[model samples]
Target chain A: MTLSADGSRAGRSPRRGLSMRAGRRLWLAIFLAPAVVLFAAFVTYPILSALAYSLYSWEGIGRSGFAGVGNFIRLFTTFPYPRLLANAFGNNVIVFVLTMLVQNLTGLGLALLLARNPWGARAYRAIFFLPVTLSLVIVGFLWALFLNPVFGVVNKTLGIVGLGALARPWLGEPGIALVTLTLINAWRWLGFPTIVFLAGINAVPEDYLEAARLDGASEWDVTRRIIFPLLAPAVTIIVILTFIGSFNWFELPYVVQGVSGAPNRATDVLGLLFYRTAFGEVDTGLQDIGVGSAIAVLMFIMLVTVSTVGAVFLRRREVEMG
Target chain B: MRRLCTAMIAVALLATFFPASVLGQEPAKLSFWSWRTEDKWVYDRMIRLFQQRNPGIKIEFIPFRAPEYATILSTGLTAGRGPDIIHLRAYGGLETFAAPGFIAPLDFEQVPELKRFPLQTIAGARSRKDGRIYGVPFATQTLVIFYNKKIFAQHNLTVPKTWEQFITVMRTLKDKGVVPLANGGKEGWTLEVLSGVIAPNFYGGTTFFEAVTRGQTTFRESAYTGALAKMLELRPYMPTGFMGVDYATMQQMFINEQAAMFIGGSWEIGFFKAQNKNLDFGVFPGPTERADQIPWVSSYADGNYGINAKTANMEAALKFIRFTATLEFGQMFTDLLAQMSAVPGVVVKNPQLQQVQAMNRKATPYIMLVGFRWQAPTGSTLLQSALQGMMAGTLTPAQVGEEVTRGLSSWVDAFRGR
Candidate 1:
């Protein structure tokens, strides 16, 4: 009797109140619907499908039979899986480390130089940002030709300078192939971080830098203490993005190396290894898609773990600088 | 509210199921996707001819360039939206497409001309374990040693008949400041021309390849290592920085007369003739060790067309396959693409093609190198890496052999587990 009285009391209120609440809810649903649907359809569905597939022995076709954890186990005991994974992971780490170091150092240095109001600073920024616009495929093919040991301009120029001895086959030698690939990647991606840092630096309040100067802080001291701290968010973003990009690096090595990650598979990364495993080779039989999916899942897990750890560390360092 | 929910559910179900029902009433139009954009004109003409021959059939030709094709095909296949017909290259992952039964096996009676295709080429299209032909072999290509006639004439060197003579010619050419052979190891497959094809002859001959395939001999014990040793031996004769030169640039070097010989496939005949019409070049077998042992040529189906197993218009698909296999269609396609036709008795009128045709006929049965076969997904990569390592002095021949053996064994194990 008390609940009925409460319900009647609520129902007797103005219809406008209920309609208003309903309208608000409708707007909220409308605003969130597109993104929710897109996320579910593309990202979530594919991930779930891949996870499901990792447990099967299908070749990406017909009936998929359940293999349970057989695919994962094969990663350890199967032919050269251990060695291939180690080589690929090792190469990926090397690429990630080198790309991060080079991109950060070069990008920050360029940002600092541009912040000094040098002549044609805008033009310099434009020039530095140009390569990032190019597709990695184009970048890779361009560099492949540019670094050609026989007739490439690099070697020809070196030969002209009487330093012919210095010009080795950059992409051919196993020791240097990975380094060369890293350098190419850095060159292509340097523009993005530089632009990001430049934006961050521009947002730095001038008064703080002036106060630092007035306090007898040298230019280096001002940059080190003030500008650097202020730019932490940008640095965090760049590092995280670079790390992910390096881990997923596929096109440059694939196009330049022609899918073999050549020079003794010196350039092999997990991306290439995954592709070969799924596709099989001329002498070997075709791969099971189930195993390929399992490898992909493992790669995803690794990426997520690394990204999480990186986010935690970087987020902790990001503090608002007055 | 209940009525609204029921109505919405009805609409959703109708929307989803309507198209499939509608599809059943219409003539199925199949889409044929291919990566051979270079042969677009030829395919277009062939498709036109096919449509005319089969009035009820329709084929939409979708072409893609490299890398993109792989991505697009993978996406389509995964989404169950792949084309009915797909043209596959020799090297990329054919096994992946075939093993899962994504591709339909060609009906032999519908396309009996396939019987005329080389046995090795047909064998390449079959699953190693099941021996089911999943692709229709349409074309074949082989890598032969092309010698600069002018260089040979100037040096008074007969096309070296034996390996010893070949080495002697190289020494003579080296003495004259000309690189003996222009090979690009940068992309790595250039090394295969030496290792996969030429080296087998030096190691164990035809028996060696058979043994490797049968698992009687691993890649390590086979003549492949000897081939690597031989490649290392000739490293001194190759142009400095040859490691960075790609196939095109290497061919360019030969065309410019900067190099004496180019080891490459017959596909280059068209490009070479276009660049220098007057350039005198002759195709010769790779030098051999024994006098009685004829030089074996390496060849495989360049690309094969296969039907998607999910395709609805099986009859139309079979008609298209039959149309392409006809001698007239085969000749026209080959003539336009400047490739050797898989159809027997299809005479190529072009002189350059005639030469290739003659070579194809006279050469010992072409050996299907594992590099071209769909065996291990990573086999080519492994071999390419080992070769690159050997060339860079970072790996020994023994190590190269061991690495390949280990990689292949692991690949085999992975598949077996699956």
Candidate 2:
């Protein structure tokens, strides 16, 4: 309350008002202290520590010394051999692109069908979403057994259906391993996008659809014209999320394919590459923390840069709710 | 009812927070870590015996999956909080731990039984830097072929002593619509085993590896490339999706009699017996490249026990290490664990392990991996990746040989720097 006595006092001596403002700021600082401290301890500290490690030449064991940019140089420029840093990055890109294409389209299709409220709609939704709830490790093992070329149900089923020729080592083939893993990733995450899209569709006012139908517009036309534009907010969120998730793909591949991204490193993504270099893998048998940190810093930069650009691009497409 | 619920909550909270202090008794304890998930019972039984022998010392046995153990153990050790006693994988792997001084060197007086161990057995756990033994040998395992005897008999096949005869047997088995060799190419170690078993014959066994280390020679020479070719040569006789088969899948195929032969370590015997007791299996040294040559098997001491240098419970750790060296421990290891003991005088009664023990005349250090043989641990990694590439038909044998040489060059540089 700006009472005449307070206003006149503030004008007479601004120090009185300044001290009050400082007292208010102190309480604000006190309120935010826990969150600020936690952020510094866990997130800020580790990132900065890893960044420091990237600047040194350190094996997991032994005395670490400064390497300047040597670790980064070796990671970026190692050649003649196929264990190049570029291979992992390229594989990560493929995983991202393939997952976006497969996951988004399938999810959208399922959401559209189910949003009609057909018979057993909730049951179908629940069934499709079941895989998302399973632990990645369990999913990996189940899929590994399912796709086992020798005794796998997939191969056995193929053989029974006179499609024996189509049966092959799905996980073992270098050509198809990454593609298969990306598809499996999409399958596992199908529920998230479906639910998001369904919510967006339902939020579209029924009056908008009814008016279109009364005006003789078909269901498909109404959906493309009215429902989709209103669902733009969810679309943007889903696209950005899919972009981030794809770049971070690790657990499913690591669990199913083992540490080496087996079948000749065909499924070797950047995350696996970083882990193998840093922690040491049974197959790679390397524990070069410096190189691993360098890989991580590089991946961090790429992820941030691409994620920011993706968010901006996706956000630009979002339409205002009418 | 509300007061009763509140009272119950208060009691639970008090118990959770102050139980240990209130109980007023704290036993001296030691924690042990190992990657032997399948052999957990053996360790539990040994721990029971250890606790019985030392009533005051409470030992906790923690097990990790084999592939994940190195990362978990190394990380814990780096944080200065690893277990008091660590079960280390023979030589090559323990070098990483030793390099950082995560493991402590044994005190000769504390474990006098160290004097009884052969220098060769002690050598596996010895630090390459200080030449001090950091751990005691627990057991030794060998890499060799385990074949289904009944299947071999059905095909009227005798054990092949030469590469040519071996190829004939593999081809015959393949022709008869049976998997001759259950190849688990998905794992690099298995491929390494197959290649290591064959590499020795052409490269003059362990002698050649030592000579290469002394000279710092590039493996680009055909001596190594030739062995890679031999590894590739058996691909036709392997399962259709040999690259897809994993360690477990291959084991099942072998046990089920779908496959006649499996190239693996003697460590597989316990698992094989438990999985299919009805299956008849036999052991053989990997065949030689030439008929006149003697086949060399890759043998290495396994399950070497090391102590955490930073451990507070050093006395208990020393006690555990010393006990592992005793004949009583050796007897228990063999009888209960079904493994060959490294305690010089003790032996395992398993016929296959005994056969392998008797065949030590042709045995050599499993050089490809054991840190003592390969200058860099990554030499095995390079070999694994190169072998995988070759199997995938992406690289030639000579290219793989070059990769191996290149990978070891870093180790050479490190040695020269020293």
Task: Tell me the whole-model lDDT of each prediction, alpha carbons only.
Answer: 0.75, 0.80
Best by lDDT: 2
lDDT of 1 at A71: 81
Off by over 4 Å in 2: A1-41, A78-83, A210-221, B1-27, B371-377, B414-418
lDDT of 1 by residue, A1-322 (tens): 1235547655555575677788999999999999999999998897788788778776434336688898888876666677778889999999988887887789999988998879999999999999999988899988887888777888889999999999988988778889999998889888888889999999999999999999999999999898998899998888888888888878888888866677667898988777766644322334556666777888889889999999889989986965
For each candidate, give its TM-score against the true structure.
0.86, 0.89
Per-candidate DockQ values are 0.38, 0.39
TM-score of chain A of 1: 0.90
Worst ten-residue run, lDDT, model 1 chain B?
B364-373
**What does the lDDT read for residue A131 in candidate 2?**
90
**What iRMS does model 2 reach?**
2.8
User: How displaced is residue B381 in candidate 2, in Å?
Assistant: 1.4
